[model samples]
Target: MAQEMTPTQLQAWRALYRADTLLFTHIENTLRARLKMSYFEHEVLRILDAAGGRLRMAPLAEQLMISRSGATRLVGKLEEKDGYVARRNTPEDRRATWAELTDDGRKALKEAQPVVEAVVATFFADHVSNEDLRAASRILDVLADANPNDDGFDCGL
Candidate 1:
């Protein structure tokens, strides 16, 4: 049996959608102005930083929830901006190229960390009570656990 959501539930869902959009937009703008990094660029840099400063192209694409072509384009842009570099991993697989974080990329991420943390704390964390945050985390964990391909999702959020 399925029950229809009430108007209040519908409204809440809509609010959640709007909140997600606004929060992401705010963060994007902040990062761009403060660090000269777009949201996607920041995400790529973050992933590289987490992967010990390097990641295979295929895995990076999967982690970023983007196509291989899309990842290549993003990597090209990052390389042009001197944030990172792509190199052929001939020993592992001659056909595949890996993206490695440059020293400048690490410096950039470190510089942006404070601003990013402040924005996150101010906009997202400050509004929620401690108990509510804990509950939301638990719910999110449950949802993530139910997904079989959790690693295929973007790491930005």
Candidate 2:
């Protein structure tokens, strides 16, 4: 059985929902205008860049909180349309595959980062006090581990 949420928890959930919706909409629009890609795609590129510009397919899917098929489809778009990403088979295990960020993907991520950083600074950072940030960080960190599958941190609406 599911535990009931306290009234305060319910209120917090509502507030978080509203704020997240607004924030993502703003960022997604900004990204669409400048980068011509969804925020998720941008995130994939960013993650690949951070992971030495490559990651195995299974881990990438998990990190993205997407099914393997979904990850493959998304990567396929990145591969076919813009050549921003590519896949390779491992010689040792032909069944194992990896996706790598191309130079174009790196350049695209670099271009998008400034826009994202500026918007986050203006809308999120400027309003929140340092104390509030610390408190929220603690709360989020607690919530981060609540997922049984360990995929909760990445899959936000």
Candidate 3:
């Protein structure tokens, strides 16, 4: 059997989990209340925008840390309900599909960016010292690298 965590290790884990939950909840609530956008929707747009406004469905799902079908459904909702995203099939590979952000999506993201930034500043960055912030970032990076998803796509860990 594997060794169990030490008391310090357990405390660190709990602290990380609690901090993540609180921050995520606050950000999600702020985004929904201020901009009428779900956190996932904003994340989808953010990822696509970072990828030059278009990405393959599988990679998008990978980046979103969701299942393929979940990505499809989310993209469907963004497309059908809000006209924020569009799907296109590549002629070179009929089986592969791409999700592209619409101009409206860009506009929506632009509007929501400030809300997210303010929340991050107020709830997270503002409270942590710069030294602790850097240390936390490095520690989180190591944790993410150590525990990677098993999905075929590169987790970028």
Candidate 4:
């Protein structure tokens, strides 16, 4: 059975939720306004770039913390509309597909990198001390370890 959260715990949860939502919204809005890129799209490109400009579709979805189909749609848009990504099928496995970052994607990421860095620093890093950030990082590690799966959380919302 699930244990009921104490008042303090509930308050902490609420605070965390509000902070996450607000921060996310702020970053999302800023990225959209300045670069015309959604956070997820930017993340996809970033992840692909980090993976040496190419990754299998499943792992890409996993790293993005989204469903495979969601990754597919995003990749499709990046491929067709933006020409930022390309898909290639593996010879060993006909079903396996790789998402590769295009030259345009690299240029876009180069452009958006500063925007993301500045926004994160101004909106988040400025407010939190190094000590606070370290403590938060430890706490977040615990919370993340409690649920180690890579699957998305569905609250039926």
lDDT against the true structure, per candidate, is 0.81, 0.85, 0.90, 0.89
For residue 123, model 4's alpha carbon misses the true position, in angstroms, by 1.1
Per-residue C-alpha lDDT of model 3 across residues 1-157, encoded as one tens digit per residue: 9899999999998999898889889999999898889888999999999999999998899888778888899999999999999999988998999999999999999999999899899989999999999999999999879977665543221
- Per residue, candidate 4 scores C-alpha lDDT tens digits across 26-133 of 889988999889988999999999999999998888777677888899999999999999999988998999999999999999999998898888878899999999
* TM-score, one value per model: 0.82, 0.90, 0.93, 0.93
- What's the lDDT of the predicted structure labeled candidate 2? 0.85
The number of the candidate with the highest lDDT is 3
Q: How far is candidate 1 from the true structure (C-alpha RMSD, Å)?
A: 3.4
Model 4, 119: alpha-carbon shift in Å? 1.1
For every model in order, what is the number of clashing pairs? 0, 0, 0, 0
Q: Taking the tens digit of each residue's C-alpha lDDT, what string does model 2 give over 1-157?
A: 9999999999999998888788888889999998898888888898899899999878888878877777888888888997889999988999988999999999989999998988788778789999998998898878856764464343532
lDDT of 4 at 4: 98
Q: TM-score of model 3 relative to the true fold?
A: 0.93
Across 1-157, the per-residue lDDT of candidate 1 in tens digits comes to 8899999988977887887788888888999998788777877889999998898998888877777788888888888866465545777678878899888888888887787788888889999999999998897678557974544554332
Better of 1 and 2 by lDDT: 2
Better structure of 3 and 4 per lDDT: 3
State, as a TM-score between 0 and 1, how close model 1 is to the true structure. Answer: 0.82
lDDT of 4 at 84: 96
